[model samples]
Target: MTTRFLRSSSVLIGLAVCGILPQLHAQSSPPTEWVDPDTGHRVVQLSTEPGSESLYFNLNPFTPDGRKMVITSPDGISLVDLATRSVEKIVSGRPHIIMVGRKTGQIYYVDSKTENGATSRLVCSIDPATKAVREILKLERGQSVSTVNADETLLGGTFTERTDWDTNSYFEGGPNRRTEARTADQQRDSKGQLMVERLDKHYPMGLFFHNIATGETKSVNRGTDWLGHLQFSPTDPDLLMFCHEGPWHKVDRIWTIRSDGSDLKLIHKRTMIMEIAGHEFWSADGKSIWYDLQTPRGEDFWVAGYEVSSGVRTQYHLQRDEWSVHFNVSPGLTFFSGDGGDAKMVARAENGKWLYLFRPELLADRSDGNLDTKGLIRTGVFHAEKLVNMGKHNYALEPNAMFSPDMKWLIFRSNMSGATQAYAVELEKGDAK
Candidate 1:
């Protein structure tokens, strides 16, 4: 089956004619609603704050009922009512956001304070409706919480012990580490170098579980492989998934372990050199782990899935232009969303600057009536549809696109208005000119 899919030239011309060219400046009060000329999708700016942004692609920022979404901005953490699109600042100061409780409908975050050159992080949760706050625990300077379990009984995170290395050394020699002193290109290169250094050093880190009720913390797994991206399964309270953080091509990347720290198993084994897989996320049902897969580092792209129980694999191929920084599935699994990357991205995808909606079509089975060949790995392709033109947006701020709980909109962040802000594109494209 052919893997390449071409976009329309007329749509590109339409976008250019609409003044949606690259590097468009910000407006004091950008339009709240507008129809995307490239795809005719109705795009809505959800936040009024200049630097507002949604949670990371893997994090769940929506409340259990899906009526409210937790967003962060220069002001603080806020809640957006999906029905009315009203924004309310629920938390005042800039606290590091953890994740919303899947069952409790509470917003979890970390409030930090620096005293005598030492920082203390207080883990807390807030009720959006009642505006009540609950303090969970205090973490040491190097300790942090990343995720809450399915039942909201435990918090999962990692702690690093880097006594031998100067923490400031990561950014010390890199053009002064100030935003004003370094261009985005230089910053990107500097970060890449820091990652290489960290990976080569194999810094000591450990995964831990914090009991919210007992206020007890227990170390589960310890390693020097640069442990990061800790996430608990949305369905299973005891199952936790984490990654060996580094350059994607260098590490095994994904692994799963019990909350109590047993059964540490690598999810994907590299079959060939330069084969890389990372940016993994769980399916809505938690039955499969989906991730970006590249064979020989950027030559080909795929969104691959692995069944945890059956050990089966499925891969959906996409064109170079369809490759996204992050991909998310709808609640109903009807379609997938891609926050496309820029030209400077690893994919080097020119004209890849668009928010895309993809319909996955599974390739037909080719068993040839052979029982032995049955149940082989399934392969498929994505039918891409452009939703929002991202040409004017900067790639430095990734558009971590995710589906709304109702699957009606794709929520993402963009700096098309000169400052990072949250935006959503309606899936139905209703009455969009």
Candidate 2:
């Protein structure tokens, strides 16, 4: 790949025409396309809109045809043609995006309207091509729609009882809440205290399903544990996964259940004190569930997998510097990618800020001359490769990286250019260092 550093006057003028230079006037414009000095991989900016961000790591942003991806900005939701690198605004509103329909390629989102201090969420889906929208269901206050099922028939989400302290004020407070600025350590401590208080309260929450065709809603399960991170299996419409959200170490986080409120199974049980697992996601084939696992909070790291059918376990060990806030697998399950974290994160890695590609290599068989003595659990190590040097990126804006449909690029969000924007790094063959 040819490296084009944006230092010349001509390049700046070109970027100005593209509407990217004005946003970078306070800071020097980062190269629109360049080869990383630390890693030979090529990186390109995908969205020209300031404050543009890619979808969450677990959410499927690509359409069913895999030719275009849906991205969000302050203006609205837009589509990026993967082949031509062209962007087109599709939905124009401040709607909260759910996920793209797995079968219909419709963009599903929620639009909120507040009336007389009461809020109602309208669940809707739009045809990306024609911009025609169909209102599916209307959710009452405190109700949310998070995931669309594999067949596009059911919408999975959670409903929570409103409380005076439910505004996530622990993390972000109103202007009048604090009179003085707090240091990073003080802020972390305050947030931790709030989390502990909330967890102890055991707030009431419920998991629900909404049928898109009939407009019927059903509550599947109700509990005090904070229900969150709801996701449906990409291949199995009935299989839904959620987490008991809290400080990771304090909760047995990963759980799966059927759509009809049966077979509620915990995916992982902490084996030791401070051991934690979260950030769970389903494999492309929906045969396995993967998550970031730490042996004992912040000490050891692994990308662990659970086979839903056979109840088997697989883990790939990673170094401290390789730990990421999120990890994702390719469509073909060829490899995995990580958006590396900074020093303030759990791993506290000195040189951890980078985009990484990992190839899992299973451990050699250790059963001495016994072919049938293989252990129930599988172990592996990652052959790590640096794809992009993210030393300048602000971890406050997570990189939420994932593989493109063709597996030729890794998409992520970054604030390296002084504004949060979406970017993609080319996964070039024969370019491994």
- Kindly state the number of residue pairs that clash in model 1: 1
Candidate 1 residues 253-362, lDDT tens each? 99999988899999989889999999899888888899999997888999998888888898999999999999988765679889999888888998899999999999
Clashing pairs in 1: 26-417
lDDT of 2 at 317: 98
What number of clashing residue pairs does each candidate have, in the order they appear?
1, 0
lDDT of each: 0.82, 0.83
TM-score of each: 0.89, 0.87
Q: Candidate 2 at 342: error in angstroms?
A: 0.7
Q: Quote the lDDT for 263 in model 1.
A: 93
